[model samples]
Target: MNIHIFQHAPLENDTGAINHWINKGNHKKFYTRLYADDPFPSIDSFDFLIILGGPMGTYEEDKYVWLIKEKEFIRQAVNAGKKILGICLGSQLLADVLGAKVYKNNKKEIGWFPVTLTPDGRDHALFAGIENSINVLHWHSDTFTLPEKSIRLLESEACVNQAFLYETHVLGLQFHFEATPDSVISMLESDSESLSISSDSVQNSEEMLNNLHYSGKSNEILFTLLDRFLAL
Candidate 1:
């Protein structure tokens, strides 16, 4: 399989946790680092496209010039029937490109949280092995409305639209199922100001580090989702 990843920042790129899953199959993986001004690939260049998360908001096109082009590329990829995965900000971008409204949630989710799977998510083929409610790492404050023709998947206490399925080939997850200990640290280091130690929805750096085991379980669920997604 030919896989392409769109990374919004250096530290927030694909981590070893996801590498272990995607590397299981015979695949050639490529990257387009929008933070570094790397050129976007042609839609036909890859069979699958994975969009990684970043600190930037989806609507901040004036501050991040590449975001506009990135959304367009994602839209084209979706239309082309490419199997795609979008994480956090990538999910917001996907929702925006698909005509969904992206906005700030009432609370920012920045720690370990449980996501309850919707009825469709529980019965969905892509989430075959995933449980109805699972604790996953959350670092995003923005949430999106479900796109047209999309099935709502997961919901958390702070975010209603935690995950969504756009057709059979497109998946968007608000939480970071692919987060590793290192990636979590990188995120904290890069955007520490966003963390609120006293907030009900946020966890401190120490708390985040101590609960690294949650990431392992999340990654297992991610692997299952990826396997089922690729099989289709």
Candidate 2:
């Protein structure tokens, strides 16, 4: 399987969480920030499409012209029966492509938080037999509306629309399941100006990377999800 992973920014890489066990499949990365003129390929050429998170908002298609085309590309991919996964901002963009509203949430959730799976999620293969609630790493300020054809999977205390499934082939996650320690530190350091964390809760990049609750168990669940994805 050849998966096409769309990277919106330099900081948000795949972190190799999904492909930890599935080394047989191949992947290709396309950075929209650096190459705004790059055209999207037909959905048939790729087995799966994974969109990584970025610091941009879903509605800022004008400010970031590449977003408009990226959303359309995702829409076409999902409509073509291809497997699709979106993380954080990528999830918001997936909702936008599915005719849902995306906007700022009441609070900026930027640490580890517990998310409970819904009945539909409990029944699905990706989340089958998984615990009712699991702590996941989150770093986003925006949230999306539950799309018309989507099933709400998980809900956190701060964000209700943490995960959703539009179709059997499409999945959107509000948390960072693909985050590695290096990628986490890269996000905190490169985007320091965007964050406003105090010295107590989240002091610096190193502290955020060293946090056990966020990074420790995340890879386990992430690989579990990826294993299900590869099987599908």
Candidate 3:
């Protein structure tokens, strides 16, 4: 399979998601960072497009001029029938481009949170095998509306717009399923302002890293989703 990943920041790189492809060992991977010196690709060469998260807001387009271009590319990809997955900022971008409102939430959720699947998500292909309510890492202040044609998937205490599926292949997940232990550490180390969490709700990097007791089922569900897409 040919896969192109649009990475918004260096710290929020694909972790287990890349590993999912690497374990297959028969796919090609390409990465581009719009904020950095890199440029976007033609978008036709890849069979799948994975848009990773960033700390920047969707409307920060004025500051990050490439936002418009990236959105156009993503829209074209979705219209072209390619499988796509958007994470955090990427999820907001998908909703915005699809004529859905993207804005700030009431409270910024920045740690492990429980996500409950709605009726539609319980029957969706990507969410296949996922349980009723699963805990996933959260680190975003922005939220998005479900596209008119999208299927509502997950919801949480702080963010009602946790995830949505526009079609059989296009996905927008607010929470991080691709985050690994190292990626979590990198994020914690890089974004100090986000760590202003009170002692009661937050755990430091060392604690998070040592806490392998966290559920792996959500990660497994994401893997199944990726495997299904690649098979198509």
Candidate 4:
């Protein structure tokens, strides 16, 4: 399969597990580094599209001019029936493109937090092997309402819209299941200021670093979901 990634930031890209999965499958990989003015690829070029996370909010088109173009491309991809997965800010962008409202959550969740699968999520084939509730990395302040014809998948104490599935091909996840230890370290280094804020949902650098083991399970879940999603 030809996999294309829309990377929003240098620090937040594909994790080791995702790279291994692509290599193991001998899939062709492509990228559009929107942060560096990388041009978007034609929708016909890739089978699967993965949109990675970033610190920016989806509503910040004024500051990030590329957002407008990115949204247009995403809309085109959706209309073309492409299989797309969006994480964090990527998910917010997807929601906005689908005509959903994206805005700040009441609290910023920036740590390893437990999100329970909704009844729909629990019964969904994509999460067949995953537990009902699992801890995943959360580093977003923005959340979105579910898009039209989308099913709510996961929910957490800090955020109600943890994940959603749209039209069987498009998915939007509020948390980070693709986080590896190195990726977490890079996130800490690049956005250290977010941790300085006093919030019950935010974890300190040491705390996040100490919970690196969580990545192992998270990655396993991500792999399973990816496999099932592709099979769908």
TM-score per candidate: 0.95, 0.87, 0.90, 0.96
Task: Note the Cα lDDT for every prediction shown.
Answer: 0.87, 0.76, 0.78, 0.90
Ten contiguous residues with the weakest lDDT in model 1: 14-23
* Alpha-carbon runs more than 4 Å astray in model 1: none
Which residue pairs collide, candidate 4? Answer: none
What lDDT tens digits, residue by residue, belong to model 2 across residues 158-208?
888999987677889998876666666667777776457552322355446
Q: CA RMSD for every model?
A: 1.4, 2.7, 2.2, 1.1
Tell me the deviation in Å of residue 212 in model 4: 1.0
Q: How close is candidate 4 to the true structure, as a TM-score?
A: 0.96
| Model 4 Cα shift for residue 96 (angstroms) | 0.6
Off by over 4 Å in 2: 14-16, 19-35, 197-207, 230-232
Better by lDDT, candidate 4 or 2: 4
By summed lDDT, the worst window of 10 consecutive residues in model 4 runs over 9-18
Best by lDDT: 4
Query: What's the residue-level lDDT of 142 in candidate 4?
Result: 91
Best by TM-score: 4
What's the count of clashing pairs in each model shown?
0, 0, 0, 0
